[model samples]
Target: MSEEQREAVLDEALDAAHVDAAFADQLFGVVDALDTSVALRRAVTDPAASEDRRSGLVHALFGPRVGEGVSGFVADAARRRWTTGRTFVEALEREAVRAQLRAADDDGTLEDTEDGLFRFARIVASDRDLRTALSDRVVPLEVRQRLVSDLLAERATPATLALARRAVAARNRTFDQTVEAYVDLAAAQKNRVVATVRVARPMTDEQRQRLRAALSRQAGRDVVVQEVVDPDVVGGVRVELGDEVLEGTVSAKLDEAKRLFD
Candidate 1:
């Protein structure tokens, strides 16, 4: 299926608890069994076959392990029918992302992805050299990937790393989107609302703690925070929680004052 089609399938699963929980469990079972299906697994993973052939193999192999619904969904994936197991794994991985968001009881994992993506955008925007390399289409995937690995070493979690890899692989033209997607995925994993905050300077640990507590109270759940320090704020704090913005800065106050006078 096209990416649009695959996403549509995911949307279908997400829209129905009957799908996300029950059908997803079945998908998980079938993919897991693909390792053992021997003959059918090989065919489903083959690139030469038509979608019909692959779907047929999937039906034959996992019809027993999974329901008719899941087999149909798997067999319908156009990319998996033509691409390597890597793409299939990525699609499954995306489902796992959905599973996590479902488990966290968040709708679509938007806040989480937004927090991560915004931070990545800020990081890329702040560093010209890194941005140039990451966004360069001429840069081989291997090189860009290693750059991410080396940079993220000890800095980002394994989940974050995997997210970056997938995003970069899928959309190499914009690493910023990859970063955002990675963060959203992380939010799903942690079952927390992602709130990325910007400060003129690094926030004291106490300030971060206080912010987290306040956001949690407001959100009625634990909210994960990603701190970003941008000196241009000229000594103010800017907090972005989803679409909500809390601005506390002399500059903002001055701007407001100027607007009032004008």
Candidate 2:
């Protein structure tokens, strides 16, 4: 199935689970099972397989082992059409992250966990060697997990650690991307989208409010602006909302002008 269709399936599954902590752990177990088995991944996600066969495979493997609801959730996922095996797996990881975030939300520590993840991502982004170490496929998964634990042991909440470790364990995404995805999931739980806004200088509260309102209107969803005060920003602010970028910075405009002249 297309990416949109895959997400639609996930949305249904999440909606059914609501705010259950046990469901999240069950979903995480399903993700762990899939991540460890290449043959299993192929069997469930194969485009040529009939939906019945896919659903049967999920039931046969997980029905006796996992909770009934969890098995049903996996079976539902298997019945969906995925464009590729990797896409199916990535969709599963997204659900796992969402599940954990839901648990955090129930505990009232979700905001802290979300901010902690963003801070950790920024830390990883700033260190080239650390980023390489975390994202390197050559590194053993245990080593990477241990590294994450070491770095976050005291600084992060248990939910944050669990989410981060699971992201790395999912093994198909870069550390930065995985953490960012988790952050986005956290934002979604709060009914908002994250818009990275870079400005030459710090904005007043009024400016921040107005910019967020404008972005919310444009995206047709509530937007939470994560402001970055960039010393180099010129002309205006640069807004990054998902894949769409609005580059109103002076440098970008000057570059565009040069291109037009050429």
Candidate 3:
């Protein structure tokens, strides 16, 4: 892949790895309700509208109950750029993740289940045909929801099934995103920042504790770490924090070295 494409993919991977659903949605219902708000969908989606002004309009549009954190993301993104219908998705995703993280906590009991949920999302996202089919707007919401339920039956949580339905009915986003939204919600309920860690081997308790401490400091909150072993990583550890990744694997370093000679 080209550098920009690779970077975008990495960003998505990191963001997906670091965040979860319940937290991502919170007041997100408000953002989704925008189209339902009024004829303003025309004003907000208008290509001619100034980005800053469209953003300002949202403050009066959604109200303080939209809350400060969600408002920050929506307002800022609007001020930054006028998004096309497709690009408007960018701001929504950002708001979702930020809101979710703010709601996460130390117990984070749902971390593993949430991880499983997103893993399923990535699996669906990898299949082009399946991804396209699930995201198709032409399909009736009821049909699409049933289709996803049949596809994931016995595999996804009941809650997950509901989210798939909602994404189709509400967001018009892909199935993968629906799964991701649920995971975000699960994580937010726990009130902790999700950290995906790739280690050369399973981490010892001490190792996990120290790592969590460092990450907690960086994130400004308790950090819940998920451990995955990648022997090919050779040595060191890699941690994904939000859109950033801290890579320290021996294989990665060696590959960098080889690239230098090439």
Candidate 4:
């Protein structure tokens, strides 16, 4: 299916009244089932197979195991055309994460969850030992999950702790990468764009508000600025939003001048 079609399916699924953290966990369970079973994935995603057949297969396998809402959601998704079985599984995973974020939003903890995920990602990135312990497959999954709970249990909201532990699963990505994805999803849930702003010094509240307003105008959407005060930034601010980077730092200008001379 095209990206638009896939997004439509996700929107419809999430519209279910039962779309919450429990439903999200069930969707994740289905994703794990599909990810680990090639035959099951193929059977559900086969283009030649009739939609009824695929839907029936999904209902038969998961209907009893998951909630009625999740079973119906998965069955409906199976009836749709996906580019690949992997893509189908990924769509399910994405829906699961989005559902979790939506629940957090309902509880007014979405911002906390997003900030917690970003902060934890930064922590993991800066600490080699912690990163290794979390990312190393040799370290048991249970151990890694326990470590996540031990570190963030008291400090983070329930949604944040749940997502942080989920990141330890990693699947096809690193732990930090998974956490970053969760942060992005949380931002997207609020219909806002995320801007990672790097600067030499911390910005005052007024400065942050001004920059946020500017970015919101540029992107045509509300912007959430995640500030990173880095000594190397020298002066000015560098904003990273999705694929685009707005660079105005002294170091960036110096590099541009050096390249011109070369």
Q: What lDDT does each candidate get?
A: 0.61, 0.78, 0.57, 0.83
* Order of quality (lDDT): 4, 2, 1, 3
Residue 90 lDDT in candidate 3: 40
Candidate 2 pairs with clashing backbones: 1-81, 1-82
Ranking by TM-score: 4, 2, 1, 3
Instruction: For candidate 3, give the lDDT of residue 176.
Output: 69
Worst 10 residues of 2 by lDDT: 253-262
lDDT of 4 by residue, 1-262 (tens): 5967887767766866567789888888999999999999999999999999999999999998999999888888888898889889988888888888888888899998899889988899888999999988998999999999999878998889988898898678999889888888888877888888877678878778877887787789999989887767633567787877766534443343223212
lDDT of 3: 0.57
Give a tens-digit lDDT track for model 3, residues 152-183. 78775444444555555545555666666566
Best by lDDT: 4
How many residue pairs clash in model 2? 2
What lDDT does model 2 reach? 0.78
TM-score of each: 0.54, 0.80, 0.46, 0.90
Per-residue error for 145 in candidate 3, Å, reads 1.8
Model 4: runs farther than 4 Å from truth?
234-236, 249-262
- The alpha-carbon deviation from the true structure for residue 109 of candidate 1, after best TM-score superposition, in angstroms, is 19
Show where candidate 3 strays beyond 4 Å: 1-113, 169-182, 198-214, 217-220, 226-237, 249-262
lDDT tens digits by residue: candidate 2, 1-262: 4797779778777767764567777777777788778898999998898999999999999898878887887788888887777678778767767878888888888888988887787788778998888877798988998999999989987778887776676455677787888888899887889987777777878777777777788779998777776767544467778887767534543343223212
Question: Which residue pairs clash within candidate 1?
Answer: 1-77, 1-78, 112-184, 113-184, 117-180
**Candidate 3 Cα RMSD after full superposition onto the native fold (Å):** 9.9
